[model samples]
Target: MKMKTAVLMAAVLAGGAACFAAGAAELAKVENWPRWRGPQDNGSTEAGRYPVKWSGTENVLWKAELPGKGCSTPIVWEQRIYVTAPVAGQDALLAFDWAGKALWQTTVGAEKPGKHRNGSGCNPSPTTDGVSLFATFKSGNLAAFDFTGKVLWRTNLVEKYGRDTLYWDYGISPVLTEKFVVVTMMHQGESWLAAWDKRTGALGWKVARNYKTPVENDHSYATPIVVRQAGAEVLLVWGAEHVTAHAAATGEVLWSVGDFNPGGQKNWVAVSSPVLAADVLVVPYGRGARLHGVKLGGSGDVTATHRLWKREDTGTFVPTPAAYKGKVYLVRDRGEVECLDPVSGKTEWTGQLPKSGANYYSSPAIADGKVYAAREDGVVFVARVEGKFEVLSENNMGERVIAAPVPVGNRLLLRGERTLFCIAAQ
Candidate 1:
């Protein structure tokens, strides 16, 4: 599928400006998931009251069969669901209806495939701006497709931008802004964060991360989150060796901090992206387990003066910490769920999950006074978010879930190992 070059400039509105559906109402009210984590990149949802408990046979509104396997989270806009998959030698972009029916599946492109584990296809999640859906693959192929599976425009990041050398594969999901779609191409030789025209897939500009050590595929897979810092919007990126900021519009490096780990380590991987709450930035790095919070201030190069409160040995390399209220909630790889004060980096409360294993890849989704977590053992646990963790409900889908669940309206859209289910209150 090839997209036409018709780049347009229109401000994408939040979900609140729409009509009311019985379960999910406005766009912000619960429709557009947009990116990996929900709106605002915070995991917390403006979605209506979703159910606290659901099983395979209970409260399952519908179950749809996917075309192929993928770890990419499902993105929704209006009444359509978009997902990406690679079939045979071609990458397929499939669109499904609200009732769990396949609408159209189109072949986007085919290229040299990257290595992924446990049937995990490309980790790129599709991003929509309420009008168009933007997607990227492990092969460094990025494209913009319409609501239906029609391609709009495409670009080969490896050919145009340079080669992608990320260790595992390209897992960073793209984010859409008012004028451009931002992508993180953290690779060797050409390690940078760039912005492209949202209407047409044209390069606007790129800010390079001039690293002392040669660029490694081990740079970062962490997605960029747009934050309002010091009265202006800044894109925050955290990965292998550094945490930095860039102008969202022009791809200019606003500030940076490097040498996060003194002795360069290969096992060290930054899978979790940066989480922002107000002026404070909660950046987590692991395999060694360290989570830090830096307050944003100053102009170009704020690494020396802006380094603030850091919490060590408190996070997993996979689960990105979600910040709400004044605390940050996290789920370790072994299923240790805890809440910590973002400022002090101190644990407020910790709980040993019922289903514990080393295969936990899903992140904690907070909504309506509860934290929803899904594990590899086919379990979904709900705990009360009251500083002290309280297990309220334990639900299961009887399938492995690697991708995080997307909260839309009052329903929870979960993509398991073999099925895509919509669970909501009956």
Candidate 2:
């Protein structure tokens, strides 16, 4: 008991120092990919002179080995990269250096294995505020840790809210706002969207969920996105069967669109996070697998009022679609790529990838003008997307690529089957 208390105190002090250090806005390296889809989550890599052509043999920076299986995306801050893994009977959180050296590995909690197909385990991606990293464990634990593997604080969402009653494992990554850290635990009876004090882990506001689906898959792997409009901030949440807009300052539900479709028994579901650009929320929804684009800034069932356009066939449930400029690109699970105009939802072009029989659960990354798509069979498709499909280069890593490749300037940080490789051209 004394040892636990001492460790807890040490963690608290370390957490305070990390939090009060400074805001990441001024010191955040624009070149490092900090989150799932970069800062804006539009899959945009704005760094000048990004890698256009590279393979496992060429322009290789380094590769670090991980212990277990996890589909969590890698996030970078400064000189470190963080990833979560579920190995043996423990869920481990690992930090690696820029040179692919192992820095620290902290095991968070005992694993509570659940039903998950397709080699996906503990799918929650890690999020960082440039100083401290926040991750979710399969045992229903949400923890924050410092750079040197010192745990700061942990909150078991299952103990607080209740156990996870979902079919697949939890996959929702925590999103950090200015004042709070927002998370979603969408269970059956006590489902809610809650925010905690970013500094102290105090519960801020938790709103009871009103939306429920008939399926036992009442779990959302989509992370929350923050959008500021009209001088007000709103957190966009897409869960099991509903997409909701909430007040960031409070836990009030501003608007929601329910009646979600999650495919079928042998069907795919919408696990991709939503994208926002030009004040318009581009969500690829529907269970039978259709995509919809809705304009924001409305109240109460805005589906009829703010829906810009609805596109079918080209949309995907797992791969989060990408929107840039006036166009949106959708990568289906079967390795098919389609580019559409976001304004009209019209398909610009569609093409099949070279690697046949490859499944694409990783989202496409758009850097400069090139699009990067990593397939499940370990092939990275590099193509030029301007008006038509032009394959630039196809890089094969020879391992299963499950997590999305994070674009950090000219370097692409890719986490493969058992190793994380940094691909950058000289």
| C-alpha local distance difference test of each model | 0.68, 0.68
- Superposition TM-score, candidate 1 onto the true structure: 0.87
lDDT of 1 by residue, 101-160 (tens): 778877767744545443254577788888788888777778888876788998877777
lDDT of 1: 0.68
The C-alpha RMSD of each candidate to the native structure, in angstroms, is: 7.3, 8.7
Off by over 4 Å in 1: 1-29, 111-114, 161-163, 213-218, 229-232, 263-266
Model 2 lDDT, residue 149, Cα: 86
For model 2, name the residue pairs that clash.
261-287, 263-287
lDDT of 2 by residue, 185-213 (tens): 76556778888877687888988775545
Clash count for each candidate, listed in order shown:
11, 2
